[model samples]
Target: MKRARLAWAIAGTLLFAALAVAAEEGKPKEKRKGPRLNPIAETMLRIDRIKAAVEGLDLNQEQQDKLAAIRDGFEAKRQAIQDKIGDLLTDEQRRIGQEKLEELKQGGALGREAYQKLEEALKLTDEQKQKMEPLGKELQELVGATLKQVMQVLTPEQREKVQQKLGMGKKGGKKGEKKKEQ
Candidate 1:
């Protein structure tokens, strides 16, 4: 009777161990969340926002075509700059940049001097800085042009709404102040 009980206990223990292993193996792995958008994904999301804002504004086909063209052109320029920057970054720099980007995504503010901090942190070479400067300027130009084109596509009322939505209007005044007022 003692041997039978021992055998049964051993069998039960083995079964329980197998069940625990199976349960662990069958469990779903948690998905990792990263940056809200990669560079290219960000450009596409921006374009989508423009589209959503302009919807129901009764734009003619030609104006819509122009907007599409402008978006596509800007996206290409943005992608090229992103690729260039990615190429220039070392693996370690990329890791740091990604962490910074994630922080920005999480509603963290980067101060005006953030670029200098980034430069120091990345230890960017003069040659890399030179290459980055023009690309940065080009990106700024593309953004301005894209905004102009989007505004042109919108009516006066829609433009105001867009400005407000983009936090360029009075309602967007001094981030914390707006929240406080509300």
Candidate 2:
């Protein structure tokens, strides 16, 4: 009887492990993070990429000075926004924040039109666009992968607690969703 019970326990453990591997395989990819770039910042980055890609299009001293000035001004404005958010946002600000973020990404105030203007002003080219797109994509993927790896080092129970705190652990999902395999 003891031997039979041991066999059942081993089988249960194996099944649990198999379920974990299956769930990991089924998991969707996560979004990446970096220096949180606004639409304007992203547009500026694309412009810089184009300038770097085109040979002999390097900025002269005056143009370089102007670019530096523009970047400094943008940085100052960003800092001010961060400072203002503390006084402006209330306890019920998360929904509004999400809406505003979506609006910005959409056509709220800074979207395709702004991108177009920057592209034209910077004389962006197809080759530069191709190069920059891949770089940005790769950077995002790298960040995601790094996050996954760090999370993997945590025990299943530890991961569950962290995810729950972060409000990401799903409810009523698969039984093994938060359970650690043997």
Candidate 3:
């Protein structure tokens, strides 16, 4: 039950993000004039958006149960990778990481500043970042797949509700932008 709850929270984060990336696949990429957003910062924003979108829905018991079941297979793998990454951190770094992670979990509005704050707090050694990179990447892929499965459990109407909350409609544009243009 605890695992399921955790999965649901994680699903709230990753699902819409995966769908959004999937939605943007064919568009010509736009280059920004300034420094680009870090992938971690972009992900954190997506997590907030997706989590809120899912929370706004009226999900049923069956949907909840299905999400829990889907999460069971992925949780252990995710945790193991997390543990392995934790093993690489120094004691002090781990302490700071825990504190920062908790603060982020509590929903403070850091924006892209969240990444900068973490980077400053950790002062992660090059060697540590090098070792954790692959594990981090693998964790991301696993979570993305888990999120996709969670979305599959939703009915089309429920899915649309989530997308709309994320400012994404059936055609993958901002929720009402197309209608406004037409």
Find the candidate with the highest lDDT and give its number.
Answer: 3
Task: Give per-residue CA lDDT, model 3, range 1-182, as digits (tens).
Answer: 98978655443333222222222233354453332343433444654666577767788999878866775677577557656755776788667755765666576624445455555566656666656556655655775676577678888888877666755547544324533212
lDDT of each: 0.49, 0.36, 0.56
Candidate 2: residue pairs that collide: none
User: Judged by TM-score, which candidate is best?
Assistant: 3
- Candidate 1 ranges with C-alpha deviation above 4 Å: 1-73, 103-120, 163-182
User: Candidate 3 at 97: error in angstroms?
Assistant: 2.6
lDDT digits (tens) for residues 111-163 of candidate 1? 22232233334555556555555554455456667778778776687777766
Give the TM-scores of the predictions, in the order they appear.
Answer: 0.45, 0.24, 0.62
Scored by lDDT, model 2 comes in at 0.36
lDDT of 3: 0.56
Full ranking by TM-score: 3, 1, 2
Better of 1 and 2 by lDDT: 1
Write out the backbone clash pairs for model 1.
none
Clashes of each: 0, 0, 0
